[model samples]
Target chain A: MNISAKQGERFAHAGLALLLLGLLPLALGPYWLNLVGKYLAFSFVAVGIVLAWGYCGILSLGQGVFFGFGGYAMAMFLKLEASAPELPDFMVWSSVEKLPFWWEPYSSLTVTIASIFLVPIPVAFIFAYAIFRKRVSGVYFAIVTIALSMTLVVLNIGQQGETGGANGITDFSTLLGFDIINDAGKVAIYWVEVVLLLTATTLAALLLHSRFGKLLIAVRDREDRVRFSGFDTAMIKAFIFTVSAVLSSVGGAMFALQAGLVTPSLIGAVTSVELVIYAAVGGRLSVVGAVIGALLVGFMKSYLSEHFPEIWLFFLGGMFIFVVWVLPNGLADLFRKILRVKA
Target chain B: MTFRRGNQAPRRKAVIPAAISIEETFVTFGIFVMQLFNGLSLFTILLLMALGLAIVFGLMGVINMAHGEIMAMGAYTTYLTASFIEHHLPGLMGVYLFIAILLAFAVTFAFGYVLERGFIRWFYHRPLDTLLATWGLSLILQQTYRSVFGAQEVSVPLTTWLSGAWEPTETIQLPLNRIFIVALTILVTLGVWYILHKTRWGLRARAVTQNRAMSSAVGIDTNRVDALIFALGSGLAGIAGSVFTMVGSTNPGTGQLYIVDSFIVVVFGGVASLLGTAASSFLIAQMQTALEYLMSGSMAKVAILLLVITVLYFRPNGLFASKVRA
Candidate 1:
């Protein structure tokens, strides 16, 4: 069945949109606003996860690679701007006297923004296409993506001179000559991030409601049937995977802008898998729910980790099992059930 | 893969002295032999880890993310076994290693049996969910280890016989521990092969793997097969962990390191083929060893990963895919 919400759910979507863009920012200060913005960055990946895993039957455990592509791409541009007429400090430490060839394209904001999607999309498409074409779905796809993430992490960390090694590329203070590390800058970036998130959510929702969305769900449920109907199931999977990669890429860029750093840890297998749970816990089928899931889980993670560090992993792990066993569709489905009961 | 100038010094120095060239060649050969041995030891570990993973995945189509934790459980069992033996049975020092291996297998096998009943069986057909659920299980297990073991790296004391190196030639010295690990791995591999191929349980497990419905119809007790196969796989990982103590220290996080690599070995070797797992592990271990000789450790890992991914793109079913009706 087509699982998108019916007419009554439209109001709930609007309410969520309004709460995120208009109401919530006014309530939180710069620090919390920045934190929320960070969560919003993850929401991009979560939304992508909802689309890919929730709808398209494509479960990528390596969205962090795309996120890293975007984050590192943006970070490179900002780093160049911050370290104008001199090499980035990490490069200097590693004795890299010359600017790396790849780093050159990232000097311009236009190229950097483009590279975020440009870099990860092709990589994601090729990876997804090859596997999906071979009819490798389910756990094999997930495992391959996990390997990709692991590879990316190692590559990034190994290139100490260029990618800043384990410490990652950080300490940049400005973006396009704008002092982004300040409170006003943080608030401004947070607002932009929220707007971008809203735009992404709208785009994803529209896509999900489209003919392609139907095909995506069709491919998810019964690929052989879809292929029998003369649809290129592999192409469909690759397309959705690329779209999700783009979403994650943008989120990574936004994350770098808001959080002021990007690390190898972001693109590692652990973080990539963790990204799936956000969509999962939020209700993978619901775009808005994934965002809510990102925020809710992100907030819980910060709060729980800060107060009860020992219990945090237990809680997170338990939540994964609980979500899979009890709320397979996540909190959004739970809300839908509650609403249905009332009606 | 990044070009560096550090490792080229030895080859360049080979041009130096007329008589020294012979010694240099001998030294180079020694290094090659040493690296080869290192690769073999690595292959042994990877094979042990991947065998358990491959068996479980091949049979039941369940992806156990907690496979590594199960390995760590084995490692931890070895530690505990060693401590217990030292306290109660000091006279059984040399034989303690053997006892620890058996104990580790028993502990983890029982753990896996309970785990299959309580947790894993629920997500049998749901492979993705199984992956996520087991990941959650892994996290909990890791946390439990940290809580019990206090988060520091723990090691079993190497028996007197396990330490030191065997010198077969003037230039070549092989660590005795690695040789022991290699021997243990071979025995484990043979045991697994024999159990799966020669035993009645193996016949039933294979029957279930090939056709669960048919096997069930024939009264094979598919559920019991799944539980047994899972336990056997886990117990193998425990043996891996036990031998792992000889090579490296065990920590709460050691399992995480091997999990992805083990999965790679399983996938690269073709899912259903046991021989494929062994072959892929050897290929990967050798490639990694060679690369590490030429580049930095991290770079070698990256190169190996890239190579695996590239090879996978070409042969998605892996190198030794079993031909089956789709």
Candidate 2:
């Protein structure tokens, strides 16, 4: 078959996969639906990692920063709406008489949503421009992003009044005029999350098939060669990085909306590294792989923690080591090989 | 006192900036001196952490995100040692600080060596993979420590000699621990300089770091060099952890606090040069301490990070980066 035919086949397969994903919420119980919702949020971040790290070769260990930004944005709004008659319980207990200046703007849903997309884009853009312009790639790039994540976690924790510090922003009462605690609202949020996940995956697929996407892959594979060929590699990297950051922020916002809380844990280095693991395990080359990897790991996390909390991390560590050793190309490639053999 | 007289008169004159009033001069001079000492003490800890990180990261290009975890390991070792001293050797608890520091370095170095042999060595040139792998390692280590030590902060009992402060004035008392850290940092830096610049092993290590392929072809065991370098780097982090226990609370996740700042210092100092790391540590620490004194902690951290970003923007290779290309 020709290249175009192969591409056509992949799209058909992707559509079928997404159709099954769209029906998952309908089949699962409320508890399972909530788990699935968290999985979707995590998958979005994995997709972002695929773009920044897999496609652009920019190992950004700070996707959590953008993710937390979105989560906090939504959390602030929810907290404001929930505490309309009085101060947030934590803030009140902590002796904060009024909201800080930064928290004031997040009270509006529109502003919160806008910020979910806006905040990460600017951060990614500025960081990418500064680092990429200097030709700082490889380990240096990874270190810088990791440092950024660390700084963010500390900054969040230090701002105890606004951020809720280590306890984080929790006890949200409502989201989008719906009582967040209600079962119907939870189900509604779950379905919305599923739809968003599918939409995001489809959009990512379409984008990756575009001309710019081809250029992006080229830049990743042979950056210097592309630069010599008259392409501005830095701009390409910056653009993709901004897109990834925006997507992660959206994921974070949705996560807060579903879970009704945001914490420093969301933006910490560990969480950022977890996102990378999701992408790596699922298949950095495929967006579908990202979703699959996230859902699988998320489910495993829930199950293992409940059954054997102490050994769960050890299992994860073993799995990571196994994955790196055996399936360096990720699980998606393994599946691809199986399908190829069957065909 | 004889040396103080010559310096005291010059320092008194130096304090007067000629353009400022006496009160303004005194206040500014006082703050400057305070901030300088604060910065130096802060730099002491940062330098200890970054020096080791700089070696491993600079030489191998493996960004060990778990460097902080290793530091935590060191802190935990100190905590355990202090507990042992308290329980068994009560009279010897005062001198236990030295033993704790040494034991922390040894234990963490061994752990680092095993980690390198078992996991890190495989991901030698692949910095990205090393990052993920080490991160997983950090999580495992952190969870293990949590289970072993419990989640609460463990205090390291300070020796009497290192417990008190030097009261320069009623308003300005300097902690002895801080002074000890500064002195320890200088000694450690000098020791590292001696190792990296003077010794035969250091020459081979530098040779491998500069050109891995060529060094290997020239019959140098690059794998052994890699492991030793990692062990040494992590050992420095261990000493840092030991020093930290004297000044702050040691917890399962206390490593997280220093990880970013250490990375900033390492990168800002220039990845490959020990001197660069030390200089950058001093500069960044002083900047952060002064800013913290002036602003809120969060604001100061943000400002320092922003300053780092600005510095990176101007000099991407860092302040003391080698001119070699990849």
Candidate 3:
């Protein structure tokens, strides 16, 4: 397609972004590369936050529910594959005589993949419809999401036989004949995850750069004014929230593939809140900034927990304070001066 | 943990799927009473935390996640006071808890004052910023506690008067501390209610809550009111923590444990209504206690939270929401 000079410049920036992403796999060794692959998965969730929180102004503290949903779905599929010719181990342990009919669909790779994309849409829609229809906004929405997430975690932990308990759905062996535990396999999955993350980021950028995106911001700033303008504000808010949830779910599914285990802890209150914090530190409003932020926070968590275990919490906490007080816009905004224009 | 485990008979029945006998029904009826008693102890903690939360979240619109840390500081203060009594003032060991409660209030009140002046003031009118900053402060406080006091849970030596239970019936024995806590919550709630309804400070606080600009215009010094009411809320949380030491052990992360639950209670009850908060905490505690007998611990929690969410769906403003909230 022919493009103008301004459009060409934008494409160049996108190309540069891809180039930087490409350089990462080359520079890092296999282990660090795999670790970064995990971070890249997290960026998928962060990118979702840029849309949900930054644009829609709906801070979903419970996105982990969708994340966990995608993860458990992926893990179930992998578990079914690994268990080939027998039922999953948890079901066996719990003395389940028959394979649960519900899990039958996951036996097919196509169903599993489709579910990774589809499950969160209905879940987000129902939740958003219930609350947003009533015009619940701001902190109340946050509390609702947090409560939902915590409920999912508890449900996962409690339903051990059906859902694999607190240890979660683990012992994944392969994904579509790709052995995930090997070093070569790790890099393969890492690339796959990185690509998915890039796709997610691109999707978020497209949404954020659209007129729908500006309307989302308007709803955030003045809901009454926007509603008075004859826009079905609830539908717009619900639609964005659903998209964000589905994005997070894909991230969670990818994370399950990379990490080779999906636990309820991933869907807990703390992890969900941390996702938001990473998005905030990256620049909540900027899609690319959030991806970088997730990587930085993930690196800090791993690096700090390794070298300075005791100081890690303080450091992360301090980062939270620093981001809030000194850099309200995040590390993303710092480069805004050099760019000399808003993205 | 104790409340969750205390009623094991109900748990065994819950795990057994579905079967009930006439004798078992009679026992279940008694157990319901027992669960209700156990619920009082749980409710006491919820009420204590929810009251302070109502003041901060409902009245002021601050998303102060560190409110739990303030409560934990109070618990730590009690632990310290009890230790001090046992070590230095050996003769006053019996009287230490009273002093501990008072000291917890003063310490947390001052801490809240400093926190407001330095950190909270900077983030005024920004709920999201306030939320993140307070959460950061919570992590810092939790780590500081871990550094200073170590990670393990510690119990304060209870005075003999506070220990032991009263057997009001053959199968039901209620812990004295829990009964005392319920009584204490009543006293605290009444004190808060009276202060909000009757006194000059309460008037100023209410005026500011209803309309900040108008309150300031009337020479009420709304900023001072914000700071004072916040400190009062923190101080109330401290007292809650002090009372909590009687029923539970104190640890660095204990605050984090209850922060979500406290928020749920306050929000589910209705943001600004003290009576609603009171009703919701009692209702939630009873549900949790009774449900624990029937399901797994996490499931019971999940069910209770689900119930709250369902309730919120029907009444998004909460059970007893004030009409004026933005």
- Give the candidate number with the greatest DockQ: 1
For candidate 3, list the clashing residue pairs, or say none.
Answer: none
Name the candidate, 2 or 3, with the larger lDDT value.
3
Q: Output DockQ, candidate 1.
A: 0.72
TM-score of 1: 0.96
Candidate with the larger DockQ of 2 and 3: 3
Each prediction's DockQ against the real complex: 0.72, 0.52, 0.67
Residue-level lDDT of model 1, residues A1-343, one tens digit each, is 2234565457567977889878888899889988988988999999999999999877889999899888989998999999888999999999999999988988898988778868777888887888788888888889988988898788888889989999998989898888898999999998888888888888888888889999999999999999999999999999999999999999999999988899999999989989999999999888889999999999999999999998888988998899998899999888877666233
lDDT (Cα, tens digit) per residue for candidate 1, span B1-326: 11222254355556666567577778776776787788899999999999999999887788999999999999999999999989999999898999999999999999999999988888776889889989998999999999999889999999999789999988899988888888888888988999999999999998988988899998888888889999999998999899888889999999999999999999989987889999999989988887888788888888888788778888888999899874
Instruction: Estimate TM-scores for all models.
Output: 0.96, 0.88, 0.93
The candidate scoring highest on lDDT is 1
Tell me the tens digit of each residue's lDDT in model 2 across A86-193. Answer: 877788877999877888887778887888878777778987977888898777777778777877888889878767999998887776677866778778887677
- The true-versus-predicted C-alpha distance at residue A143 of model 1, in Å, is 0.9
Give per-residue CA lDDT, model 3, range A40-144, as digits (tens): 778888888888888778888887888888888899899999998899888899888788898999999899999989878887897797789887888888887
Interface RMSDs of the predictions, in order, are: 1.2, 1.8, 1.2
> Considering only N, C-alpha and C atoms within 3 Å, which residue pairs clash in candidate 2?
none
TM-score of chain B of each: 0.94, 0.90, 0.91
lDDT of 3 by residue, B1-326 (tens): 44555465566668554777777766765676777788888898888888988998888899898999999999999999999889999999878988999999999999888888788988877887788888888988999999999999999987888689887665566777778888888988899999999999998898898888888887998878888878988999999899989988999989987888999999999988999999999888888987787677888897888788888888988999878736
Model 3 regions more than 4 Å off: A1-16, A19-21, B1-29
Tell how far residue A6 is off in model 2, in angstroms. 3.8
